[model samples]
Target: MKTTRVAIVIPEGLSGRGGIVRVTAYLTRHIQAHIPDIETHVYRSRYSDNALLKHLTAPFALAAFAVKCATGRIDVAHLNVAPRGSTLRKRLYQAVAKALGLRTVLHLHGSGYDQYYADLPAGRQAGVRAFFARADAVVALGDHWKRFMLTDLRLAPARVVEIPNGVPAALPIARAPNATPAIAFLGEVGHRKGVDVLIDALARLKAEGLAFTATIGGNGDLETARAQAARAGVMDRIVFLGWVDEAGADKVLRAADLLVLPSRAENQPVAILEAMARGLPVVATRIGGIPQQVLDGETGLLVEPDDAAQLAQALAALILSPERRAAYGQAGLRRFEAHFSVTACAERFAELYRSL
Candidate 1:
């Protein structure tokens, strides 16, 4: 097992704080611990999420990859790629890995990937196919993304597999029930995440005589979102904890009875899994792979994207009824433990590697 070397190529991953970075870090960490057959190395290809930083680090990243693979040490190259710049940066790694005859797995993780492919020019569209064609296998986050890779990309169906994202269990916390129940929102705050709609929904709940603390965490459009909250006269009930660290976020995830994610687009967010691991019920929009992770009505309720009225109605129901919240929360915990834990995800990858 120690002799089997694998390289995991991730862009802006080594020090980045984005969801993809966390995914790569978590899986790789567990793989090394759980599987004794493979020694894995993380080839940090773009340094930062910033465009200029990505450009600056490309040449160095390429050089590093070329040197590492030239030794013919890596038996498998597991590539974590998204769309646009992420795809462009990682192409060289896949190309070099293929040329070296290493087994390549292109793991896809982007909500807008389908649109990114469709919007590409004819020449670039062909490039996308050619890029993916180099891989020995393609890993999709869920069934929807897997269908796209096989049908849209025209890749062989046998070469694609769906491996949804997973998260580790939350740290032990002796949480005292909040007198006024807490409602939390994680990830970037912007039009894409329906943060504006969430603000409006708060106003809707206010009219219905519902009161709870709304903790909005993460970056992007805070100013615009703040103005929206102000206009809705719900600023008093909202708390903006800008860019929460892992520990800080875990606290919110554990304490909040209902975790809300009103995203317009998604591909099975790890944040939702984190909430589930904490036995926290979620109220996320029914978009993309979200339905696969969050079972509406069973685990937690799901609402249409950008519909403040429905989102408000769903949140208000959970807020008012403690019994319903506990039922949903416990059901969600069962789903998480059965399917989406880090150990389960690590074993899946280990089996995939063994097959290769």
Candidate 2:
């Protein structure tokens, strides 16, 4: 069998910190591992931090990507699309691929895409429609996004593929006995992420005379989250580690007893998978592809978004019961190995590429 030559275009850098970046990096690594016969190349475009420049240069970047795809010895081109203000670039890239007669895949990476499409201007909406119509396939990270593309966006069901994000192997660490119950929140510290909600839950746990320390990793509006913790009188107990790379973040996950994500909205979160792979139980909000990854009451606990009391109850239960925590953690690790491992994800993609 001839090897498939694949070109991956990631305008955003490939540092593996954010969700999209992590997915692209992991997918590329997996492809290289499972399909060693497949030739893979990555093209990263430098995006300016300025919003205006980022918007204006999108078409040019796509055109450049098109030129590279047309000239290079590539069989398939995969573009990672995000709904966060990059719709124009995604459309342009898709159009260029269609014009050049190259098979293309648009791998979407965000949640709430129906709302995002409705908010687009009429002209931009038309462009987006044309782009999706012309692409060979549109890959959604989970069922929620696959449904959004089929029912809401009205894309053909045959063109959309549901591929859940997977977790990379965790670094080796000496397992710590269930001694101190440390809770952790990993992600942006913004309002949408519900950092304030987590702080409130911690306060409620304290009010009920529960003792636990929560460590927060990743950065976003830190001072505000700090103020919320201070107001709740749990400031001293909450440790803010700020932004960390993949390796450093994994270390934090390994040390925690439970991982908490109170996000108001989310796509498949890489942090949650990382936690599961590290044998830590998760307490996350019921939103987006999170439900697909975390089986409620089995591997982890799920609470409604922004519900402080429910979150507090869930956290307290795990903290007070070492046996329950260990059970959940072990279950989570098993789930990770069975379904969310990097090897399995890569094998699936290899099959998809062959089908294409």
Candidate 3:
């Protein structure tokens, strides 16, 4: 039996720390473990952060890709793309794949791609559309993104597919009922993630005399976040745990009562899915594909991005009631198992590979 070869293009592959890296690792692992007819390979697009090294290594990466195409090692090119440099790099890969007659799948993962595209010059915008138009299939994280591809990019509706990112389930942690609930914020610790807004909300909660402890895991601008938390006088209540690997994230999610991510933008956060998989509810901003994952009053609470007052109210509601947290957590777990499990996501992609 001949297996379908899929080269998954990612930045730094499994070594990187971000939603795209996590998704790539999970999906490849699942396919390797469960789907015998599909062979997945990781192809790194971006090198290190150093500008000199990135410029030096880029041509080598592209040359390796061309060699793989020339040798017939890969049947499909699965490009995981975000915005800016990612778009430029992937356009070259897509051109190479088209030249070699290999099927290509562009999996869109950009949280702020709309703004990025809008900011581009008309010629660049046309180039981006051409990149999309030439793909064999374009995978969107959710229906919202699918609409963007169809309405905004003017791509053929039949060429677009909606598939959410998924995570493996974590063992649920058992915690004794306490007066103070433990809250968690997982992802980057910067403005884009709205950590400052979270601090403001925490201040409000503290002012309201709400008893709670919070942990923020992930790296990005810790100095500013710490300064803001200290100024808000809520630093004592929150613990910052730099960038966490899969195990660290699992431990954080399992131990926490609920997960909160006030991101200003997102494309279906994997943190929310991971929290849901661990049977923990979420308090997140209603932006990007988040609303698709976090059903407003059901699985978790969703508030407007950067709105401290609304975020504080939502946090207070969950913190003040353990029953609500448990209800929401269980509902979220059910949703995860049904719609966003790693097994399900991998199977969907495997089917897509076979189709191509």
> Which 10 consecutive positions of candidate 2 have the poorest summed lDDT?
42-51
What is the C-alpha lDDT profile of model 3 across 269-289, one tens digit per residue? 999999999888899998889
User: lDDT per residue, candidate 1, 213-270, as tens digits?
Assistant: 8999888879999998898889999999888767778877877878999989887787
Once fitted onto the true fold, the runs of candidate 2 whose alpha carbons sit more than 4 angstroms away are 56-60, 118-127, 171-174
Better of 2 and 3 by lDDT: 3
| TM-score of model 2 (CA atoms) | 0.92
lDDT of 2 by residue, 133-153 (tens): 777888888888888788766
Worst 10 residues of 3 by lDDT: 170-179
Model 1 global lDDT (CA atoms, 0 to 1) = 0.84
RMSD in Å for all candidates: 1.8, 2.2, 1.3
Weakest 10 consecutive residues of candidate 1 by summed lDDT: 169-178
Query: Which one wins on TM-score?
Result: 3
What's the lDDT for all of these models? 0.84, 0.80, 0.90
Give per-model TM-scores: 0.94, 0.92, 0.97
Q: Predict model 2's lDDT versus the native.
A: 0.80
Better of 1 and 3 by TM-score: 3
